[model samples]
Target chain A: MLAGLARQGVELPSACQAGACHTCLLRAESGDPGEDGRRGLKPTLAASGYFLACQARPVTDLRAAVAGPDVITPARVERRWWLGPRVLAVRVRPRQPVEFRPGQHVTLHRGNGIIRVYSIANRPGQARRDGLEFHVRVYPGGQMSEWLAGAAPGTGVGLGVPAGHCFYLPGQPAAPLLLAGTGTGIAPLLAIAADARAAGHRGPVTLLHGAAEPARLYLGEHTPPGLAGAGIRWRACVQSRGEDIAEAAADELAAQPDPAAARAYLCGGRGSVTRTKRALFLGGMSLASINADEFAPAAAS
Target chain B: MVMTSDPRPLYDRLGGKPAVDAATEIFYRKVLADPVLSPYFDGVDMERQVAKQAAFLTMALGGPNHYTGKDLRAAHAHLPGIGDEHVDMVIGHLAQTLRELGVAEPDIKAAGAVATSVRDEVLGR
Candidate 1:
């Protein structure tokens, strides 16, 4: 069965060839299936034939596909950069043509043979250069971080195409947009705001960027030049000065009329993202209208 | 008020680091083929990315908190261009990962809820 799928060029999700990550999950359309040690599968899914393809070898001829229609494809790295001590930017191109709404992320295959995920920081069409762009921060001693720090330009890498669900939805033209981001987390938010402006969006757009210190913010030069005159309000909040940028932004958002009508996007440290969401939700924005992404260090290995 | 039985200790239920490590690897392989989600990893270093994710899972699942690194927003601020579809794509990946790990339906739902809770911070919608 595996040979047939490979012959058909049907690639399944996998990571840690040692039976980890569980990216390739499928349900048996019809067949007797066996299971192995990969975690995350529920008895219900198992009873219904759900199994991780990486861990399960077909006992008999098996017919299967991902339980959901969402299939992940590998992306090729087109660019790389060292933004700061720990931040890196990698641009990836999809093996196939694709489109995304903005504020999404893709999983990356590092030189050390590990797969990590990062957010898309370039506008949808703007990535026309060769591949999509991603912003990553390296954690000291992190498998990918150490490799990226020493990697020279044109280094080959692996990636998964746009994978996150956080993005902007159209049809709320009159509603105010409050976009807040910290460090690399700002990548997706910036893409959303930029796309809105480039597409001639007319709603009031405000961007509040925060970092530990002013120097930590990386994309000052790459900020969309179009937003300066496109009615998109931009602000930088440096939290090291003891000013709660997220709180201030939330307060400003609260002052707006019909807070429920406003849409808020918050990205950054887990603490700030959590605080911003709580503050804004309590300030009256509808929970459905709020979108966020939180990036933090991996738990100890 | 009496607290409900908290299932916060899901790491043990999911088979700890070995299980999580395996699931993380499979999840990345799937992400690579996903047209909608693969673009974000264009120039990424896959090895380090994998380790960071594993470390993150370790901490997220209430295991040992070894992920002493920068927060998410700071790490991703450079790209500055993401959207709704991207956010949704990530959530979908997380959901798929959970499904692959053999996590129970209730556990998967709980994990989804955690992912949903952070959607705003991720997409900046």
Candidate 2:
């Protein structure tokens, strides 16, 4: 449905086009979205004609518009700082309570109509309330990144519905958590690890992050206090000049004991995510137990 | 004339997308659980694999031919270690999945025949 609409020159807000991300959610004013289309949506959202446009295959003519109030939350930049060369950490607080899991991503809408998907790096219900932190890798000549690099605090922005499958899921307190990511992909993994700890997970949690050079490894020796728990292992992997960070991270993860039984969350660039996912799978992890969030590069406008 | 077969396309007989979805889901679960077949999917995105498999199965069952004639052959040509045995194992899993899902004997056989028809292509012959 989304592709067909695009062919007709109607581009909808979309990311992770596989229905895992709710960035393309739309309100169907007329047609019925079958159960499959609303599979993971909240009952209330489904009741109000909301469906994932990427998943909807309407048999009859359908009219849908970008969702308003129900999906868009007004937010403001609370703080911004440089974590490393080309890495910016920004915090935004939603004007209204926007419930979201730590590792889920939100579509950040700047006033100028530029939007980019970013994973919330902080856990929900912190002492500061609804502040969402994002670790952004500012790319040279990237519109959103360039704007964000100099955006002042308190600047208004709109957030799309927070959606992603890579967040920490409860009810598996005893399953070991293995998180691996490259570059800013560590944002969501860190959030997921903190969430697991907050949920009182008793299993061991191991976090592995990799970067091209030591200077690019921002989170270096500072493991978040939230992740301080028994049997926790946090390691920053820095490879030699031209080595692939993704493979290096995957090698470390595959070396972990009992990879098959571990609940793994992998995020980062496409190559990194794919390599790490393959490593874990080959290391005996069940594909169902592995969740990956591959960052899609925004088309330069 | 006595009709020994239902004239409907196997896709319809298999009950469309929902049925194909169910079959493919069950089929992958079974394949992944089987040590012999699971390695073939190493590093392959399971979700995409399921979707592609569903589309291929749908076309094979005569629903829609979204696939080009050389797609299956071309895809398998690059993968190592695919032999006639692997093809048979996959067909067996497909038939077993339909059977477990309560598909009638004739329908399962028809589906198996469709899968078997692509045996050489799937084997990269």
Candidate 3:
């Protein structure tokens, strides 16, 4: 809600400030209740006239509420394994069931205040059978990846609520679903296919996970049990060094016969997402039918 | 003046929606009268064009960031031979509209500064 305000110069100090922090919390003593201002706030606090300024979009005049810390849950590492040379697959079990949709990202915080965000890779079926799976690549000198490298099974961790909108939607079961991405972007695509299959989508779901070389393709030989008999088809493409990932994916998407009948999702680097969206649009897909999530480079901490 | 809005944004201080409506109306009138800028809107729907300009101004003045129009470069890419003279004529019309609306001197200068910042992009340089 404050997104529009921020665009108009009414600056609100926010980080992941995702209503998890007191940064945007405000009171609505009187006036139009903000649209979902009470979302992350406690019921008692939300009921007695509290709301988050970041979440609250007041259609009418309103009083601001004071802020508080977001509720966080504890998670314990169940197990982990390396998918290939570069990608590490780590599964963590929260103490209790965590409500989240496939394709949403969660914020993980270490004990000493080191915070990192990662996408949850487990589909609903995988979540039930295993736990939350995360696909993390070890970037040189990356603190979060370093910590995960040494983290032991049963180690304690904290997770913020799941957030982001690049997930599969039910009720569109028959629409052709196109999921394409590079590198760790395969995590959300895996989860999306799992959820779509679980939701009984009979339509063709095509997933193209790309990398610079054949060895970097992590899920190449291993197909998920959930998608084995389901109607989901997965493919991996290896681009020569410096070959654009989106260009490679767009070539595949443009070959499809009916672009208008497909809902295409493209993820990964900003350049790839933007180029693929443009390519898809040029290939006859409506802009509204395209959904994209860009993993922009994080700023130097 | 009867103030019916909740709080004043920068757009409101510049006389709100009605002022934007009027400014676009007058600014285009000035533009269409000039030979340098007239051809750009020759066959365009004036009503639609006015709405787009108002939305652009609203965004530039710290109002709702709801402008859905193309970025300035993309919007002007089709025009041929657009140069400093065409830009001056367009900016002159906007400055005239702001002056006519009695939008304070500083605000008008600020608005002009904002417009000038996009000169290269608008010129597609």
Candidates in order have lDDT scores of: 0.65, 0.77, 0.69
lDDT of model number 1: 0.65
Q: What stretches of model 3 exceed 4 Å from their correct place?
A: A1-70, A221-226, A241-244, B1-125
Best by lDDT: 2
Task: Give the candidate number with the greatest TM-score.
Answer: 2
- Provide the RMSD of all predictions against the true structure, rounded to 1 decimal: 18.4, 7.7, 12.8
What ranking of all candidate models by DockQ puts the best one first? 2, 3, 1
- Cα lDDT tens digits, model 1, A22-110, are 33456778875576622445455466666667667677877776544234454555667776656787676766655666887655565
Residue B106 Cα positional deviation in candidate 3, in Å, after optimal superposition = 42
Give one digit per residue, the lDDT tens place, for model 2 in B49-120: 878788767865667757765888887887788898888888888878777777677766777887888888
Task: State the TM-score of the second chain for every model.
Answer: 0.75, 0.85, 0.80
Question: Residue A175, candidate 1: how far off, in angstroms?
Answer: 0.6
- As a whole number from 0 to 100, the lDDT of residue A175 in candidate 1 is 79
| Residue-level error in angstroms, candidate 1, position A216 | 0.9
What ranking emerges by TM-score with the best candidate at the front? 2, 3, 1
The true-versus-predicted C-alpha distance at residue A36 of model 3, in Å, is 12
Q: Rounded to one decimal, what is candidate 2's iRMSD?
A: 4.9
- Which structure is stronger by TM-score: 1 or 2? 2
Per-residue lDDT tens digits for candidate 1, residues B1-125, read 11124555666667778877776666665665577666666545455676766765665555675443345555554655776666666657766777766566666666566555555555543
> In angstroms, how far off is A228's CA in candidate 1?
3.2
User: Candidate 3 residues A1-301, lDDT tens each?
Assistant: 5687667876543434445443344556578666477786656657767666667667886655333233457888888899887789889887777777898777666655455667889875576568788998877787677778778999988766566677888886677788888888888878887788778887778887878787888877345565687767676767765556556556656666665678887767665666666556545565557777666443334
Q: DockQ numbers for every candidate?
A: 0.02, 0.13, 0.03
Best by DockQ: 2
